[model samples]
Target: MTEKRSPWRAIVLVSTISSYIVGGTVGGVFLGLWLGNQFGAKPFFLITFLLFGLATGFYGVYRAIEPFIGDEKKR
Candidate 1:
């Protein structure tokens, strides 16, 4: 069986993926900055959280896309 893909699907997927990565990174940076400032250890926490964010963001993308992948596999 063949599946028909919508043009908007690509747009939405790209947007959602970008949002996942960007949102996680930006949110983490801000939160880390705030916490670092509170703790008086700016760079350390900021760097750590930024890496954490990167990991979380990619993991989120994988999770978000996993169902689609499963569907394709079943087909």
Candidate 2:
């Protein structure tokens, strides 16, 4: 029999995923800004960061629901 997961585990996982994605987005934006200066390109660092955050958020939501879908298939 599979062990049951606590509600806190689900909460923590979701929070962790969201945080990591947001942080990665910020880092990417900063990198873009720096590289843009080096290459003399007009880099829209803010736009990149926002898009990353948006994409990651969608992924996070998908991940959050994935466990439910998997659990159902096992039944």
Candidate 3:
């Protein structure tokens, strides 16, 4: 038998995932801007850190969902 999951859990998970991605991306952009200004290399740092942030965000999403994936597999 499959157990029913709570709707609140889903809502919380979605919220967490969104926050992780948005926070990482936004934080990266801000940091990149600051660093670029400090080092006088705007374009390079901005692009690099933007990509880094995206990667970090995706990694975070994967990590966050890993437990749920494992639970599904066990069932």
Candidate 4:
């Protein structure tokens, strides 16, 4: 039998993924600032945030696709 997903699942999934994206941004900029201050790095915040966003975005996309890609399709 095929499994079914509750409509709420999409809402929850979107919310969760949005948070991850936000976290990546925060981590990149804040972490960069702190580390840069301590190590005198240039554009630390910007660079960190950029890289973090890329990685986090990819991860988020992968996770978002899980339901659709899983062995059992949820209707």
Best by TM-score: 3
* Cα deviation of 8, candidate 4, in Å: 0.7
Worst 10 residues of 2 by lDDT: 41-50
Which scores greater on lDDT, model 1 or model 3?
A: 3
Candidates sorted on lDDT, descending: 3, 1, 4, 2
Give the per-residue Cα lDDT of candidate 1 at 19: 87
What lDDT tens digits, residue by residue, belong to model 2 across residues 1-75?
Answer: 244467777787778777767766776677667766776773575566557766776687677666766665676
Q: What lDDT score is found at residue 56 in candidate 1?
A: 87
Model 4 whole-model lDDT (C-alpha atoms): 0.73
Model 3 Cα lDDT, one tens digit per residue, 1-75: 233487877888899899889988998899899999999999999988988998999899999988788676666
| Superposed Cα deviation of residue 54, candidate 4 (Å) | 3.5
Model 3, position 37, has a per-residue lDDT of: 100
Clash pairs, model 3 backbone: none
Once superposed on the true structure, which residue ranges of model 3 sit more than 4 Å away at CA?
Answer: 1-4
lDDT of each: 0.84, 0.68, 0.88, 0.73
Off by over 4 Å in 1: 1-3, 70-75
Error of 3 at 7 (Å): 0.4
TM-score of each: 0.83, 0.55, 0.88, 0.68
